[model samples]
Target: MTSRMKPAIDIIDQRVRHAMRQVTGIEDCSAIVTPATNAKFGDYQANGAMALAKKMKTNPRKLAEQVIEKLDVSDVCQPPEIAGPGFINLRLKPEFVIESLRQMHSDPARLSIPPAEKPRKTVVDYSSPNIAKQMHVGHLRSTILGDAICRMLEFMNHKVIRQNHIGDWGTQFGKVILALWHVCMAIDVHKKSYFKNDFERLQSNKDNKNELYKICMQIRDRHDKDYINDQLEEFGDAKKYFGRFLEKLDDIIDEIWPDILLAYRFVNLLDDILPGMGLRIITREKKDNEWKPVERPYEHLTRKITVMLQQGGEENCQEEDAWHSVKKATMEHCDYIYQLLNVTLEHPRDSRGESFYKDMLAGVVEDLQKQGLAVDSDGAVCVFPEGFKNKEGDPLPFIIKKSDGAYLYATTDLAALRYRVDELKARRIIYVTDSRQKLHFDMLFAVARKAGWARDDVELSHVTFGSVLGEDGTPLKTRSGENIKLRELLDEAIGRARSVVEQKNPDLSEDQKQQIAKAVGIGAVKYADYSNNRTSDYIFSFDKMLAMDGNTAPYMQYAYARIKSIQRKAEKSGVDVEAELKDLTGIEFTQPDEIALAKYLIRYGEAVEMALADYRPNFLTNYLYELTQKFSGFYTNCPVIKAPPDSRRQRLLLCELTAGVIKHCLRELLGIEVVEQM
Candidate 1:
């Protein structure tokens, strides 16, 4: 007898293309079909003909008929037919689907997603949380999204470089340093207060120190604003010239530094001078003797300011220039968070704030100016892209060089961009940041394009994402309105998972709970983050995620455990499953459920290939979930253990395949390990 088999996907594709040529009057017309959204509609559906019909100004049903007649896929599929409105439905031959499965089982990297025609280096910049300040929900989306994209691209045979563009340099460091040095009174204070401290003590210290420094900083900043307001008051008669006076003050400050410098005492100068808005520094660093000016009084002013920000200032200097001081502070409570939550990250790069970029700014500005992409606006250098608009819908510029020669995020990004493309030779650069910066990226891309740095050979993409919201649909925040810390959130998840694990399996030792809780909790959270499409927002919910039911990590994990359980039972019974597939030519799927389960068991490579094509791991997640469910159905409907010896071994082989697929899916999707037992 001649053996019957299924045609591979490529064969079907070619036959469909050939049929299109023979049946359609228009020789150039072709169709691409996708799996039907609903199984009731048939295995595959092609709406391409209807779409073409719209463009050709013809009847869609007639067009679908022509395409179906031209299609030559009789070997792999039944003849296509026009369905509702104009969709062409295709039912694949079962023999072909089954043969494809057998081939996949024998091949190593199974469903063989072809390599890129010409590969290019891709740099993924993500997980860029700032140092010192605790990571919050803001960092969660980017870190997870970036990691997922990198994982997908790598699986598809792309060279992916991972970059943790940590906020190592920035003003927040200045605040923490100044706060820690001064408010805590001594460098040793950090160790003394933080060591062995409980969460409450840490929380109290962080709140107190941040609030205290903020109030003092506020006094100076408010004083400056008041000074600006007083100037405005004096121009009441010339109200229309209000902007002119503000402009004059902006210009005068540069030329009249001494007058402004002397107006405040040295201590007050430090408070005002260090970068920050309310209670923060723009960026702070150790009081370095090398960077300080060698002139008289300027040295004394810098030192005194440093002390005021670091080791609490003498109470007598409230009148000092606010701009002359640097205050250092630490989020003392963050230590407790790390302890309670049980997660640690490498120390962030030593970036205090904007001041860290001060030197780099000059190089970036000069480059932009030389490239003719930036022009001086007022006193600052700026780059305005073509279509960006201001509040009045007038064209606005992206401020790269501040009029006072100050550098902002735009300038820093340009420097970073240059470093990425030039030093790294990254043909593709993907920035995983908040969607709120859409306009910023657009202008940045335009600037790069205009500067001739981003050519057809080099590509820049913004993988933007939506916010993580609370149960109430607002940004997830603490009760006191502070953004919840990322470390704290993760810790709570682990703790909750520990509780669940202990309740479920009380026989487990303390060490097991510790290890398993990390997996379960972290897996649940990461899976929740990833299972959703990256561009949409999802609510932060532990309870919903932890329940190992209906599309969850635990559900997939449990399915893997079930297979391991069966494997153990087979071993105990001396079933000898190893020799089962040696000559598997006569394997039979006698039960309806067995045949159905076998179908899913054999399609792992196809699911993975689909996910690789779209860069979405949710496809993998859903696939594993359904595979597990099918296995459950098979177990209930078919008696594997009591079957004839050969049949039992065949079923055991199926279980082994299930375990492998589950483990692969979890490890690839959420970076979780599968356990043989609960």
Candidate 2:
């Protein structure tokens, strides 16, 4: 393989820092080289001498002159000049600029960008959708942002392990299984859509408690009857009926996937209202060598089922089968979303959910107890990591195991951390979650380090982002105040984009229009999220995102498509664009626009490095937007096909490089596609 090319800014920074080290006799002196604010001064300016002189208590201007005497950038830059206040201004030589562009043109795969000097195995955990639930608007930022982080790191030659820590275990599954059983019972025994009707009824009557209580009572009565009748059937247990239902679970999954959310909500409503209603239900438990009958409160049914599922064995085979079926259905839903969004999470490979670490929870608690880091607090096993306090001025507990013998999210996260460190051999682990979980991760990292599960050298980062708000400055939701489903949101975006494409270029073929619509629609949503700072909340607007002008995806896509059009036109006019670019020896920068675009083109690697440094995609987007504007200027002022014979190849070369950079950054790094024609 060819060697990677070091970025120009990095080279300049190293040279200036080396010169500073020689002048001050400091082993670790830094030259903070940044892009010049004004092009009149220079392309880049180093502002380190002033700070160093102050630290050493010497003349700033004299210090800059001493550093310049030792600076040797003759290969890339012109003579370095000391500007006001000991600032060193340096401009790239024309030959150096031409050589950089030539190198980038030759290396199309990576744009001649070098990998990191120290590549490490990095684990990024993101897009953790719960089992038996549809992903909503809340999951948008983490999913795309985390995917971009992985792409950039991998492009920089790091071994990236993508973890989809889905919520597949715990009390939720019991309710889900119960909901599934209700679906089966409604279809098979009652020959009616009982839960579907009850779901709507509950929603409509939720405000009237008396009517809601009446509905809950009616549902509980039927539930109790079904429970008793199944146990007293010819098979002598509920297994035969549920087992037969599980045989055709796939067909049922397709039928109920759309209604699973409704059924789940119905169960939750019942669980909340059926309590303290003095209702009872019959259940079975094994005693000695026979099945014995037991009665429990109606509301406690789901919890009992949860315990049964957690304690896996031959008798609980029905629950196990149901759990697997539910998980399979839920993941299929999530996989569709991932594919739709162009995300890189593959099912069963990148998916290591909470259930994967179930067996290790006990061992984690036991080890913490042995290490004197865990103790019983209010009947729960807790570890009070230092520096966290409650409002009452007491050390807050990081509860691992609850008083009811249930493991919390903290326990699973700790187990996951240990696995990533020891098994995956990850030197750095990033958790891409919302800002609300900042305190949780803070305590998690502290507890992990205190328990020696995460070594000091291991880098643990909680990459938090702000929420996507509606026009009203609140979290985006449907008219019913429910989380908007991700699938529906994306579909609406594509639908809206289709209309725009139809109006703009109605004569295009249907297939072409569809492709453009998909690209523009999906790219717009992703680019809008990426353009904003991850730490600041921004209002989500389809109108703003889909506009044809201003820092939007449609604008960027259109820019790339325009360049492609120019190339095609050149080909039709008997211009062998490929041969010209390949045979080109050097590029002459005669116009101001040409020089401006060329200078910015060589700094593509700098943009990638800055984005990777802070795990922010906005930095990359900002660079691309600026590049597009510069290219626009060049295209308007310096015509490509109409240029003179000598300048033709240089203009074409600029177009090729501009298109190449935009496509790589958008499609490869950001997981957003660009249309060849729009």
Candidate 3:
């Protein structure tokens, strides 16, 4: 199936394995073929022979020689070499390298990253932002990394289902909804920007410890009064007004969306500061089989709302209505962020938040219990998957249902895994999240395997990434130690890029400058992240990312733009680049630079294979960076426009292929936009 489009490494691996079978009479043999660790050894090195020899009790070098005796890779590679420890080094013949490029050049649509022979339904769960908070700097890595993975997988013809898995249903919603009620009351009855004033004061005094404490105390006092007075409803009082306000919530949405988010943050901050504050808020309870006022603990108020909303019924109509309204508005907020980030996540379509799996949480616990995979531990439904234990040396419980009958993330996640398998028919689920969730996912996969929800054929992976740190080696945050909003971070990046663009190319039209800045700025942020090791913490530096000299988005964009400018120059000088290469006979690797560039250019598909094999974008980025570096050497050594017709045509082919590779890696695979000018 992959005879035409299989990557170079795959082709080599197959040939080596086939030859190994002929030599050793083994039906299947591991080739362990990989790109050579160093170019001097050759283009590829087959290290599997050593392990196979150890297994069969044969000398590895002897085995390598025997395998080479029958290996039929001469059409593609030079004569294989036996190196140290029986390493069989294979270098492609120049003709094969040139032929590979010709294939990619002829079909720019694929860029040689052909569709997978056997496509699988893959679910990539990522960027699960909390509904109560704005998207922050902490969310940057997962969002972009996840997007790139989805892009790369989809490019390879995998049916990728992007699940946002947003944090929509939880006790946090209680805080936000309760806070929202105050926002409704403050404006409707008090006729004042109640939280607005306190919010401003808090922000203004965020750094002054004593002043901040005083402001917080005052705000808490007012908050207490507002929450308490709602129960003192004398027909025209706060409770009745709350009911009327909920009725009109749809109309006041636009006016309250911004303030509601701030108020929600205020509630979260207050909840953090005042621990075990047994204070209660007024809400409705079913008494005499009718809804009536009831007081609940401030801390548990969020829980009440969550339970009520999750257990949807006529009794919890108001609670459900309120949640739906807030959830809808939050979707708008997330949609705005997605648009600003150039992300492909659609609002409701891609969003399969925790709430979406609410109804299935209980059934998940029940089914696991029925299958003898889940049991009650301390009144909580738990699956004690093997290989996990607590500090007490007891098996750790993956609590699906808490003692209070409330479901945790584990329950919803299990439900999601099942849905993706049974309904979505997903053969692989790639979870993109921070490293902190590593233990959780390990337990999750273990439980799924134990329950037989995911079969042996189904792939479950936790693509964990490290934090995006500041230059100080701490998590990037605002001056007040709060999370820096993703919007502000991206806006600042674009602005910084704008200054660079205007300064470097003031002659570019204003629209063009903005377009370039947007590309450079956003591309810089994404590329900087992509260029780093995904499993290691990386410091986010605007200056470093926006710099034109380093392995950054701007650098890559500028390099691409430089090559594009050459094409423009060529056309302006009446030289058609396409025509020069359209009927070109052959490429001449005259100079060392030309040969090096050509060698790297022909390995584009190999780079794609490596990156997608392990789901690492950095490999692809590294390849593009090296390709550009090699092209720089080639551009300096080999004159395209001024050289003789033969050399000029060869250089032009390099330019065209190099440009195509960069554009594919950046725009197609990484979701990064490129510019035609710096």
Against the reference, the lDDT scores of all candidates come to 0.60, 0.89, 0.83
Query: Highest lDDT, which number?
Result: 2
**Regions more than 4 Å wrong, model 1:** 1-32, 59-62, 74-86, 107-117, 187-361, 509-511, 588-592, 601-614, 645-650
| Model 2 residue pairs with clashes | none
Write one digit per residue (lDDT tens) for candidate 3, span 1-678.
Answer: 222456778889999999888888888799999889998998899988898899999999999999899999988899999999899999988888777777777888786666887989899999899885778988888988898899888888899999999998767766777777778777876887677777677667656767766666666566566655664333322455576777888787777888788888776666664445445555567667655766666556567766766676754466566677787887787788787677788889999998888889889989999999899898888999999999999999999988877889999899999999999999999999999999999999999999999999899999989999989999988777889998899899999999988888889899999998888888888899999989999999998988878688877777788889888888888898888878655775768898888878877887887888888899999998898889888878777788888887888888898999899889988888988887
Worst 10 residues of 1 by lDDT: 321-330
In model 1, state the lDDT of residue 535.
Answer: 70
- Model 2 worst lDDT window (10 residues): 232-241
RMSD (Cα, Å) of model 2: 2.1
Clashes (candidate 2): 0
In the range 508-591, model 2's lDDT, one tens digit per residue, is 999999999989999999999999999989899999999988898998998999999999999998899999888767568999
Model 1 error, position 467 (Å): 1.8
Better of 1 and 3 by lDDT: 3
- After superposing candidate 3 on the true structure, give the runs of residues whose Cα lies further than 4 Å from its correct spot: 1-3, 196-239, 277-284, 288-296
